[model samples]
Target chain A: MNRVFTWQQVAPDQWRNKISELIDSGFFYFDFLTGVDRENIDGQADCEVVAHLAKPDLSDSRIIFTQVKSELASIADLAPASSWYERECAEMYGITFTGGDTSPLLRHEGLGRPPLRKSAVLAARVLTPWPGGAEPEIREDGRKVGNVSRRRQRPPGVPENWLSP
Target chain B: MKHSFIALIEDKCTSCMLCVRECPAWCINLDSHTVEVTEEGARRPKKVNVLDSFDIDYSLCMYCGVCIDVCPFDALAWDEHRALTSTNREDMILSIADLRPSGSS
Candidate 1:
């Protein structure tokens, strides 16, 4: 059995340099890369991105995580090393990761708002300028796997069953 | 029984196809720019092309949820209430006819 281990989570800004350094040195197996949005749940989400790395060979079970804990109110532009994962976080959650590969991966033009963020007003404001209304394109079984999220999501203070579909 | 439902957000999805490339049983398909899961007898796509050749031997599925997590679009989801059935061999084999969309009933 493969032993499981968890590496410490670091602040968000240092994430890129640290990860790049690890990749440069040896650990090439980029295993896990995702972000957390603590804006409502934990207060804030900036600089809270997570990444994982390990050796390709199964010998070393150690996992390393690099986090960047920096936050920004707004962005005039983007920084490098923020790749697809980080860029997506920045665009959706309003957090920025410094470094390279800094282009938004999933965000497209004409969409008015990010859906996943814990804001009801903002989600309703989300608009798509296209003819088919606003829905990101994902296809399953050779057909569009179109879905809409959180149309009637309850606020943190409201009861879970209070909001009816 | 552990039933669950999961959906990948298309806008948030990167189309990386990691889940497509990683499924062990070849149950997932990447044709329409996203990922689709067909098991038991439920299917959302009427005529599956990319994920057409899907047949998951539920007996072999460990329910690890790796494929769901691997999806870059975050499209693959879990419906915790609907766990894999511990029935006979034929029933154990899930095809595209099992899954129906959320509001279809």
Candidate 2:
């Protein structure tokens, strides 16, 4: 069986230090992330971050999880150690890494509702004018593409947009 | 070389030492009514307390999939469902969670 260390839960603000410790332990692999419902009470945002760490050989799999309550929410970005793939995490999940920009990854023209966040409070979290301009030139693997389409044209390099409105 | 691993099923296993007997590494350990893998790194199966440890010496496993094929209760499995990093012998010792859908690399 695996072991679970339930010490004082790490607050969102403390995630920076916590991540540093994990990275130092040669546990660079940022395992998993999800919103864990830790509230058995009337109401509490006791969410948790469940992470699994493995030794370099992927052995010594250690499953250590931490809890975060609503009183102290929003983890800041961990940079340097939390770069590259880390950025992707922030943009996708609202895991505010200490140094990461609290920006939306897919703001969808920066106008419509953010499909990722389900909170009613964020009805208008999307910044106006969105990120891209009207009918911005979309790029595909370096080349510009028209728009999203369903039909597909045969052959190696045919752009799928060729069949769209 | 194909990696070979040893899986333990406590209920049907009874720690009979059959798998351990067959293993040449002497890496399997029976303790706490469970099989513990002392192996440093390799695709180790994820088991509970009934199973102490599952050590797969990646350096030695030949990927024979014998452990999976030989388990009496079909508890042992060779997870080729996902191809992982082919480098580093340590990468072979799959984490305890890696044995599941969420634990995957």
Candidate 3:
């Protein structure tokens, strides 16, 4: 199906008002809202909040986005359907939506860093001995080959300091 | 026909770590070492990577078949044979020996 993509960038403080303006302009259908981690990008906000709204007839759609550090104004009051999305964004990216429900969406309360954030380390890669680290010391015939010298490589998402002695 | 699990063709695998890196679930782990092999009539010993170990944690695997598609050597394949099951979470981690097809030694 053909679709129209119209994106608008709004300030963090004007996020809620923009959603209201979109709804008044017949963009009442709320598709989805999500957060994107921008920590790795240069000269950008720590996080970006994006919301997609469409007309009921599926004729046109509008994408509203705003950049925020760790918090932004909540649009759940205007859209109502965005409440769960707001909570998810808060849980995944650690972006707090003021004036909205900031309770735990899928994870337990006070459970370390937000996993979707770029800085969050993959704990599983660190805790478990990676199969890629296998080095056979003894041959099948029972002869010791001794240690082989090679540059150690860290698994993806694991910090260098975590493996440092 | 019912598909069971992913199996590894040990001989064909070069231990490139493509499956481990591309796995979205981060369920695959691999390790390899370099060995200096002196070929006959060659003046210098060439460095070769020896596959040490490869393991796939079934508990975390989503069975997305990413590893099978990314393997350049065509080392990974889908097996119709049933996969191993256990009550313990640790037992779910299948090693290189466990991943091999039943027909191969």
Candidate 4:
């Protein structure tokens, strides 16, 4: 059976130092770094940063997760392998990393809001025309074949405000 | 001489809406309506959805075959044939009636 590990919180101030210490202690492999948006929760940061580190033999792995209220200190400078992950998280979540490259990885400048942000709503329907042409129904000898009354459900990830139409 | 084409089994299709969701090119347009289905030797009838129309716009289709792969029921099949060609854009939109077997019509 595969075992799951819990995320350990790292203070924003000492995050870099703690990662470095883990690296020095043989946790050399940097697996991934990502962020989650938490909008419903109050008194907590809107984003959470999660990073995974492991040994070369894959015997042991550790996860470090921190609730970032604001800008987070960079560990890419210490790990080197985490540069792209940091860049992606920064681009998608709009979380800045101190002493690291804040350049966008997946998006160009001035495109829009960081898509992964909790408050970021998708593009309105008016901006993007519905690709599927007019819905079709079968008519047999001037009578409908089967009549389904309800409208189709909206696509996932569409905000509630966009459901009016 | 040989030819192949996509064979659509209209009766087997459950109208699960899987092909509509999986079609990346947005070439497929489908609709369904609910109707009563009475099983043989059964006392009561069950309400089920009957597919209204399954249309595919060949003008926009890239022939990626994603829709056929995602179908839960084996309603769509792949058949080899000459390339689809038409003189007008409107002719490229294939309706459910056009998809029926050659002799059945």
Candidate 5:
């Protein structure tokens, strides 16, 4: 049976070596690489970078994550397959991938804040005052007003009590 | 031609801005303002955005039903025989006051 281990938090400097050792030990496929935002989540670091590696037979796979304070050393050279993924992580999380492509992946102009970061405020979310499922009351004159239930709707993917109301 | 086209029911419209945003040709225009008014028996004034105007430029309309589909309220409809046509291009624009049913506000 293929074995699976819990997510490991490795240091930024050890990222490339550890992944290379795993590749030399039968895991030859580099599946995916991405970043996670955990700024307000309890017992977790602000940012986490993860990579999934698998074997050609697909029987065993390793998922590893590492906490990044601000930036990390890039493993794009070691895992050439993760080049685009690393570029995307750099754009969305504002994390510098040292010695790697710093070009924007999704945001072509690199105009605003990193959208995936918790600190990046969404203008659309702010403009639309009401949450999903709450109907604004319509008046006879065709004007709609916000409901006065005093319950604030949380934005999608945001944890409760993390931001001030 | 002689087929059904778009019609706006002004009274039922809540000025939700759904139709305005969904128009692919950007032919829909709207104007509204929130006003405080006391109802017949209400003790306090209620806030509502009074719809001042809603216009659709049929000259630029591609006849796509995106606006009709996006409206939360059934304020927009398909008028079988009431589609208007004129020689002047300016006559293609229809406003909320012009769309009202006969003899009604």
Candidate 6:
């Protein structure tokens, strides 16, 4: 399959103008917009706002991305389809969008941290005991025997100190 | 055709935990213990994993079939039989015995 990949990184201040310029040039079709958490990546933006715009016939497409510390100007006014996407980015990545409806998208109440952020800890994994920690033993008269010499195993993605006493 | 449900073949399962870790929903829970098998005239006793308990919470499962795909032992398979529905939420969790094919033991 022949495919062309085009992407550009723009400053947060020029994000709204870039989308408008792209639409006027020929890419008016709005594909989708979302936020990427770049906390783990070295020397990158805290969060990256990415949007895909394509021509009406789907011949050419461009990925417009902008790096932001925590806030980005809303492009929903220029592209109506991006309103919900902006709201989703607001709730998921904790990105504040100005000049648009940044209402709650998936969350009902205020949570501690953005769920998609790398720093957000998975509380459920820590609170519940992992079943993989079970150790085998011999049974005598329905009673377990022998001491467990193997160390307990932690589930993947869970931190070591989270399970420590 | 009826909706397929996950069936566990007890003897084939070594409880390696591949399915539990691969499950994206985090619905599968398993417990296993190690049994020391000492043979006659053997240098050292070999440790074998014994399957203690395996539970799948259907409430959280998305029926993605990821667990069956990642089972290295071929212990898990899809059965054509319809899955049971329960009124209580807690009853949705199927244990090792409940996951076995019907009419087998």
lDDT of 4 by residue, A128-155 (tens): 4343323334455657774443475554
The residue-level lDDT of candidate 6 at A28 comes to 92
lDDT values, one for every candidate: 0.47, 0.43, 0.83, 0.74, 0.74, 0.83
Candidate 3: residue A149 lDDT (0-100): 42
> Which 10 consecutive positions of candidate 1 chain A have the poorest summed lDDT?
A125-134
Ranking by TM-score: 6, 3, 4, 5, 1, 2
Please identify which of the two predictions, 1 or 5, would achieve the higher DockQ against the true structure.
Answer: 1
True contacts kept of each: 0.24, 0.00, 0.27, 0.18, 0.00, 0.39
lDDT of 3 by residue, A50-149 (tens): 9999999989999989888888888888999999999999999999889998778789987889999988887766887664444434233445566454
Q: Write the per-residue lDDT of candidate 2 for residues B1-105, one digit (tens) a residue.
A: 223233333345433334433433333333223223455675784322344344454555565565556556765555434445567877766533344422233
| Sort order, DockQ high to low | 6, 3, 4, 1, 5, 2
Interface RMSD of each: 12.2, 28.8, 4.2, 4.5, 7.9, 2.9
- For model 1, what is the alpha-carbon lDDT of residue A4? 76
Q: Candidate 3 residues B20-56, lDDT tens each?
A: 8778787888876566789999999876667878888
- At residue B94, give the lDDT of candidate 2: 51
Q: Write the per-residue lDDT of candidate 1 for residues B16-94, one digit (tens) a residue.
A: 4455445544344433333445666775633222333234456655666777777665555565436556658777655
Clashing residue pairs in all predictions, respectively, total: 39, 30, 5, 4, 1, 3
For residue A15, give model 2's deviation from the true position in Å. 2.5
Candidate 1 chain B lDDT trough over 10 residues, lowest sum: B45-54
Which docking class does model 4 fall in?
A: incorrect
Q: Which has the higher DockQ value, candidate number 4 or candidate number 6? A: 6
Instruction: Give the distance in Å from residue A142's predicted Cα in candidate 3 to where it truly belongs.
Output: 4.1
Error of 6 at B33 (Å): 3.3
- The list of candidate 3 runs beyond 4 A from truth reads A1-7, A102-110, A122-124, A135-142, B1-4, B21-36, B49-57, B78-105
TM-score of each: 0.37, 0.30, 0.75, 0.60, 0.49, 0.78
- Candidate 6, residues B13-96, lDDT tens digits: the string is 887877887776778888766677899999999877778888988888788888889998889887765766889989989888
Ten consecutive residues with minimal summed lDDT in candidate 3 chain A? A133-142
Tell me which residue pairs clash in candidate 4.
B4-B79, B4-B80, B5-B79, B5-B80
